[model samples]
Target: MKKIVISISDEQYEKMDAHIKKGSALNLNNETFSGYGLILNNAEGGFSWLEVDMYTNLDLGDVNWSIEES
Candidate 1:
């Protein structure tokens, strides 16, 4: 499988954090997860080719994921 790397800026993370804190009183929904959740969702969509390959019965390897800090 191809690799997808997602990176968010410090400012972006802070904004996400603030949004989460502000909504802490409410139930979480899509809007509450538009940060990394949306990013990972889009990445999965971008990697939909793997699913397409499975539709054709291709012997694709297992999906793998990991987080790294730099």
Candidate 2:
């Protein structure tokens, strides 16, 4: 599998932070996995999602998923 990362400006980070403090969620990115899960391909995995939370501390082991905001 291939790995990827994204970076945002300080202003954008601050904006997202404020929005989260007010009680909101942000969907940074998404990708679909095998709907059949392990029943299908051995290398295939089930569906997964990555999210950005209020504190801006997040990480998902698979697919090298991680995000940071300050």
Candidate 3:
């Protein structure tokens, strides 16, 4: 198993903050998780993804995912 992190720009962070303030829930879907789940694979100790209240539809042009250094 590997650790990963998502990086976002200040502007995007602000946008997300504002969206949350307005009670807009994060729009997550297949595009965000690729239909993967953590609970389903937890017993096997495999790779999977789980997110809560995070948006999937955004410019995300500068967003990036990277392995977390141990």
Report the Cα lDDT for residue 54, model 1. Answer: 12
Across 1-70, the per-residue lDDT of candidate 3 in tens digits comes to: 6676766668766765665543343224232333212111122334333232433432324445557765
Instruction: Provide the lDDT at 55 for model 2.
Output: 32
Off by over 4 Å in 3: 24-60
Residue 60 of model 1: what lDDT?
A: 24
lDDT of 1 by residue, 1-70 (tens): 5555445556555655555554543435433432223323224444421211111222222233345554
Q: Give per-residue CA lDDT, model 2, range 1-70, as digits (tens).
A: 4434544456545654565544432223223221111111113464433344443433222232334443
Model 2: CA > 4 A from native:
24-70
**Rank list by TM-score:** 3, 1, 2
Which residue runs of candidate 1 sit more than 4 Å off their true CA positions? 1-4, 28-70
lDDT of each: 0.38, 0.37, 0.43
User: Total clashes, candidate 3?
Assistant: 0
- Give each prediction's root-mean-square deviation over alpha carbons: 13.2, 14.9, 11.0
Candidates sorted by lDDT, descending order? 3, 1, 2
Which number leads on lDDT? Answer: 3
